[model samples]
Target: MSKISNFFKGGSSSSKSKHHRSRGTPSPQEAIHKLRETEEMLTKKQDYLEKRIEQELATAKKHGTKNKRAALAALKRKKRLEQQLTQIDGTLSTIEFQREALENSHTNTEVMKNMGYAAKAMKQVHENMDIDKIEDMMQDITEQQDVAQEISEAISRPFGETYDEDELMAELEELEQEALDEGMMSMGGLPSVPSGNLPSLRPGQRATTRRKVEEDDDMRMLASWGT
Candidate 1:
């Protein structure tokens, strides 16, 4: 009796130690994976139970009225399998809800962690920066841009153009008059020679004819002007 009691105490202590040394809690990702696997297993089991229920139902119908005992037994088995299928359905629903919750929580955790990391990096980047220096840099850039724009406008401006408009117009008119005079001297108020042939007239006769034509032209011009 003493040995048996000691053995029982030893077994209890060993079981307690085992329970205490159980595995740590799984991460969200692992938990979700485990839940999905369990769901799959339960789903397969549900399918098997459904198949068995159908088989039992068929057996019961086939044995109806001919073997009442066998039919009753088949029906009883089908009912039990149906109940098991129902239980599995409920379990699957619970596991699915839990998995979804865990997945959402994990996503939120990762997002928050990344956001915190980015914020830290940004803080570090600006840790040594001065707002006053930043403002001064911006102001200097604006001033340089203004100076550059002024220089560009100065370079593009027209130069060496201080002549008076009235004087330029008078000079232009004088030049035009000189050109007209040169043109008139070149013409010498002579009639154009005929391209086909010259007139076959005596020299003094031609000179006399020309003087008479000129007088007639002058008289016609005076008449037109008076009209």
Candidate 2:
């Protein structure tokens, strides 16, 4: 375990960290790259240890009773390798968590910066505008619209001719009354009907109609004229 730690964070690591401190800090991208490299290295070590454990287990199985000492040694080595692999897994997990947090923080920082820039741009644009001026422009447009509507109404209305609706309706009623009187005079000039009491007859009608009597009289007059 100590050897693995020393291999990753040797004397050169201390010098590199000091240089980074002097040069400001490492970017999240660079940090993530280093973490991924470490993860890869640890994963390869895990594979090697797994293979050695399998070989040790095989050796233990093969020498069940005959070569117990050698088999025990192999199993002890395998146990140590397993413990180292477990520690590496824990370290890798910690590194991955830190890398992810740094990545998220970096993304948030860029987003905030872009939002700040947009806000500044909006402020600059609005600096040239006035709310009072906008209201005045809207008022002018409304007055123009009213003037246009008045002009349109004037163009569509008649120029010189205007009639009083009450007077026209009264004249029309007088013409209608004159027509009704003419119809009544024509009807009254017709011969008056014999309004005397009628002869006794059935409920629905007389035995011979008044039209039939007139027809008989006309026939007798024609015969007398021939004679």
Query: What are the runs in model 2 whose C-alpha is more than 4 Å off?
Result: 1-24, 156-160, 164-166, 186-188, 191-227
| TM-score of every prediction relative to native | 0.69, 0.69
Can you write out model 1's per-residue Cα lDDT over 1-227, one digit (the tens) per residue?
99999999999999987886785567898889999899999989988998999999999999999999999999999999989999999999999999999999999999999999999999999999999999999999999999999999999988986789999999999999999989878999677666897668999999999999999999999999999
TM-score of candidate 1 on Cα atoms, chains taken together: 0.69
Question: Which pairs, if any, clash in model 2?
Answer: none
lDDT of 2 by residue, 86-176 (tens): 9988998998898899889989999999999999999999999999999999999999999999999989998887999999999999999
- Cα deviation in Å at residue 50, candidate 1? 1.1
* Root-mean-square deviation (CA) per prediction: 8.8, 8.4
